[model samples]
Target: MRLFIAIELPDGLKRAFAGLRTPIPGARWVPPEQIHLTLAFLGEVEETAVGHLHDELSRIRIPSFKLRPAGTGCFPGRQRARVLWVGLEPEPHLRDLAAAVQSVLLACGIPQEERPFSPHITLARLKLPAPREVGLFLSGEPKHAFPLVPVREFILFQSRLSSAGAQHVPLHSFPLT
Candidate 1:
């Protein structure tokens, strides 16, 4: 199965994120329910391996923490803006949580990501750079767009790919104290 780990957002925040959508020519906004802060993306795993993955994930004991949207930016740089995203206010606890999850994945024989963890919620998939729309969107959004989002749990999600795009289904949830 194609799987990953991430923090789900609250309904109000999802609605607020949806409200940020604009009519940019080559951009597709992420659906409200699909928005999440990804911790690790595990491309594929054997059915038998899932049990071990879930067991390792449950062993994580990070405390819950609050985070908020700080601003917006593009992936692979703005000059080649392929993804538009809302940056999260960095929390050490959040980073530690991600690290713990990664450690578990590595222990389970999952390949490790060479890149460092940079937390952000993807807002749209962009086919081309929409600089004008991006600037307007940034200026319109307050420095801190949403209220503090309490992240009490992270889930191991199964991603089913289809013509309609990817749909995430929670396979198991790991709670934070």
Candidate 2:
């Protein structure tokens, strides 16, 4: 199955992000339901590996912690941006949880990710024919600062790619306790 681990955002935050979806042209906005901060992307794992992954993840114990979305930015350089995201505030618990997840995935014989973990909420994915007006829109975008919310659980999500956008379904949930 096509799977990944992530922390889902509450509706309030989702709506807040959805509000900013406009103005940026040629960018595919993420559906509110699929707005989540991914911890790891485990592409196309075997059905049998699911059980092993679950068992390993079940041992990860992290206390609930607050996360606040900070400034906006684009990945892979601003000029050649592929993804736009809201940066995350530095939270110790978040780092710990990420490290623990990485360790668990490694113990399950999953290949280590070469890129360092940088937490952020993906807002949109840009297409090649990005609108010329995008530079002005993104430049004048207003700042956003919202109340921090506690994340109590992380989920394993299955992604089914279709002609439209991808559909994310929560396959399993691991609580932070």
Candidate 3:
């Protein structure tokens, strides 16, 4: 199954992001319910290995922490942007939690992501490279200051791909103290 580990956003944050959706041509905004901060993207794995993955995840122990949606940016640089995302404030605890999870998953035989962990909530994907106006939009300082989001748990999610985009299913949840 195609899997990933992520932190679910609170309803209030989702509602706030929903209002930020603008009419950017060729950009497909993510549905609020589907918004999440991915810690690791574990591509397809054998179904039989799921139990082992879950076991490793259950061992994670970290204190709950607060995060705020800080700014907006894009992937592969703005010049060739394909994804637009909302950045999260850099919290050491957040990085440590992600590192712990990735470490365990690697020990479970999952391939490690070469890219460094970047904490962000994807807002949309552009069919083509982002336009000049999109760049301008990201250039401005974030007008909205999202409330501190208390992250108490991270989830192991199963992603099912379809013509309608990907549907994420929470297979298991591991809580932080």
Positional deviation of 91 in candidate 2, in angstroms? 0.4
Ranking by TM-score: 3, 1, 2
TM-scores for candidates 1 onward, in order: 0.94, 0.92, 0.95
**lDDT scores in order:** 0.89, 0.84, 0.89
lDDT of 1 by residue, 12-60 (tens): 9989888888788889889899999999999988989999999988989
lDDT of 3 by residue, 83-144 (tens): 88889888988999999998998899999899999899998888887568577768664587
2 versus 3: better lDDT goes to:
3
- Which 10-residue span in candidate 3 carries the lowest summed lDDT? 133-142
Those runs of model 1 whose alpha carbons end farther than 4 Å from true positions after fitting are: none
lDDT for each residue of candidate 2 in 1-177, tens digit (9 for 90 to 100): 898999999999999888777555578889888889999998888889999999999899999999988777777766777787777889999999999999998888887679999999898888853444445536645566777978999999999999987999898999998
Q: Candidate 3: which stretches are off by over 4 Å? A: none
Off by over 4 Å in 2: 129-142
Higher-lDDT candidate of 1 and 2: 1
